[model samples]
Target: MLNYGILSTASICARYIAGVRESKNGFVYGIASRNLENAKQFAKKHNIEHYYGSYSECIEDENIDIIYIPTMNAIHYRWAKYALECHKHVIVEKPFVLLKEQAIELFELSKKNHCFLMEAQKSVFLPTTLKLKELLDTKIIGDIKYINLSAGFPGRFPEGHWMTDHASGGGALYGSCTYTVEFLSFLFDEPSYQYDAHFIKGKGSADDVVHFTLLFNDIIVSSVISMCCALKNEAIFYGTKGYIVVKNFWKSNGLDVHIDGNMTHFDFPYTSEFVYENNHIQECIEKGLTESPVMNKEKTIYAVKIVEDLYKQM
Candidate 1:
């Protein structure tokens, strides 16, 4: 069994702990935080076996075979690099890093250290997403022409939240647009794409709202993401003979496909998408794989590049 160690007490950590429990091949071995009491409390609450007060201590523990990082966006490169240096496999939450350079560097380090590294992008691992890809490959939707996707939420975070701090990698592009970019990259193979973006900055240097149009192999895609407003939270793909509309697409819950004026619906009953991601991590480790086939390094780098380019345009 792969013993998993978590490096933070972030809200996302709780969900990960639950996911580990659901994965028979792994368990939450330990948890760490700057605050010892917080770590202890979290460990006890989740039935984790050990707790540490420092991230370094947790990663250095020889018993931990994998480290799950769900920390701030800006710190991902740092923690991921450190974990790799300690020869531990890592699974970091997405938007992998603030810059494409960091993503490249981390992947190199993981290879040098001969350790596994994966981005915890639940969308790609979802059954619904896999089904969507299968249908597309079978030409269920015919020739692709355009895509419209929007994902966002009304800003409710208090001041000084990391989601509002640009230096901490806060912004709609980093926060929610990762999903859109992943979808586009998944649907289309061409990494060469052109895009134009507009941003609305909020209280901090980060853009609360980001709108963009992209062209991938002649397929036009438009997306709007925000932390200041609520959008339709959907992705619509228009094809020559039919179309597919997914409500709350990122969640991988359900989708509707229309062909020749006939509508067919698909619903995923699973609650926690992280469970699938957790299983994938363990399966990779068991097979002596250094990277996930589903969320591979090339595609992850492509996704990050899209985010980086959009920011540059803004």
Candidate 2:
């Protein structure tokens, strides 16, 4: 079995850890956190074997072959580099790093170490998202005119909360919009953001709302993302013949694909699709592949560029 070591006790690791435990060829052997109790709790809850008080200790575990990093956004580059330097493969949470330069360095480090690295971009792995790709490629939507997507949520983050702090890379655009931008870039093959507009947050140190337009090969895509507002999540593709409406862009839910007067509803059962990604890690390791096609360094770098640019503008 492939052994996994989680570099943080963050909630994001819980999803993938659960998936890895359920996979026949994968398992999370250990978890590390700044708080010893936090690491112990996370490992015990997941029935994992080891709990390390420091991230360095986790990476030093020779039994662990893969490392999952879900810490704060700004620390992504550092932690990923440490993991690769230890000769362990890595999977980092989205909004990969704070800058494209950081991403470039991590990419080079992974290659130099001959270790696999990928961004944990969940959208592209969803069944609905997979279908969207086929539809767009076949021109099922017909003469794509525009694409609209938005995602946000409300939370009571206290003062000094990373979400509202600039140093922590806190903001709605990084935490939420990264998914939208990454998927759009993937489906449309790296569309250029020709037109841009946005609404800056009145309180937070980072962007709360970002409205941007991207030009695809032959289509225009418009998107608006906000964190201060109420919950609103959707990915709408407008085309000459029809449009596809994905209501809940983050999770497995019902999405509609409309063609002319006919509407097709997609019912997706919410299980641990995150684990499916862990399976990809296992397959790559077994076959000696250094990167996952679904979440390669190129896509990760592209997504990082979008976040880096958004932050620069904000």
Candidate 3:
């Protein structure tokens, strides 16, 4: 089995750990946190075999085939680089790194070490997202005209929380806008586009509210993401012949298609949304592939560029 070591006891790891435990060829072997107590508690709750007080200890474990990094965004590059140096494959949470340059460096490091590296972009691996691509490619939605996507949630984070600190890579732009930008970029095959964003600050220097518009070849994708309010968390596409709508687009198992005034619903069976992405990672590792075909390096860099540009305009 592929032994997995989680680099942090962050809440996000819980979903992925559950999925990895269910995988036929993967399991969570170790977990680490800055605090030994946090690590021990997380490991016990998740039934992990090993726990470390530091991320370095987790990556240094010789038995770990892969490491999952869900740490704060500012430190992702450092940890990922170190994991690659240890010759361990890595899967990093979204908003992969703070900059495109860092992504380039990590990809180079992974190539040099001959270890696999991938962004944990679970949305692209969703059955609904795959079906959306298939339908768009087949022109089931005809010529695409416009797209609208929104994702956000009102959270009760205290002052000094990472989500509210700029130094910690906290913001709706990094936490939420990344999703909308990635969705549009994937849908259009990384087409040449123009992006602009407006923001509202909440706690940290980061923007809690963001509104952006991306101009594609023949489509205009508009997005609004905020930590100050709750959004429908849906994606809508309008085309010449029809349109498509995905509710809960981030973890959806089904989609609704509208063609010629008729609506049809499609569903895909799975235990958890993370299961598909975890399975994909396992297959790639077993096949000796270094990057995910769905969320490859090229697209990752492209999405990073979008985020960088958005920050520039803001």
lDDT by residue (tens digit), candidate 2, 195-303: 4556577475766667766665767777776666665678888888899998877564567889878999877775686766677778878887768776777777776
RMSD of each: 1.6, 1.9, 1.4
Better of 2 and 3 by lDDT: 3
In order of appearance, the predictions have TM-scores of 0.94, 0.93, 0.96
Candidate 1 C-alpha error for residue 36, in Å: 1.7
Q: Candidate 1 on 192-303: residue-level lDDT in tens?
A: 6788899999988889998888887778999998888878889898988899988878776888899998999988867576788889888888888889887889878877
- Kindly give the number of clashing pairs for every candidate: 0, 0, 0
lDDT (Cα, 0-100) at 90 in candidate 3: 97
lDDT of 3 at 53: 97
Top TM-score hit: 3
Scored by Cα lDDT, where does model 2 land?
A: 0.78
Model 1 spans with C-alpha error above 4 angstroms:
none
Order candidates by lDDT, high to low. 3, 1, 2
| Model 1: ten consecutive residues of lowest lDDT | 183-192
Residue 30 error for model 3, in Å?
0.6
lDDT of 3 by residue, 1-314 (tens): 99999988777789888889777689889999999999999999988889999999999999999999999989999999999999999999988998999999999999888899999888888888889989989989889999989887787556778888767878888886667767666766867778788988886787888898988786888898888787888999999999999988888889999998899999986787788888899999999988877788888887788888888876
Winner on TM-score (1 vs 3):
3
lDDT of each: 0.85, 0.78, 0.86
Residue 202 of model 2 has an lDDT of 40
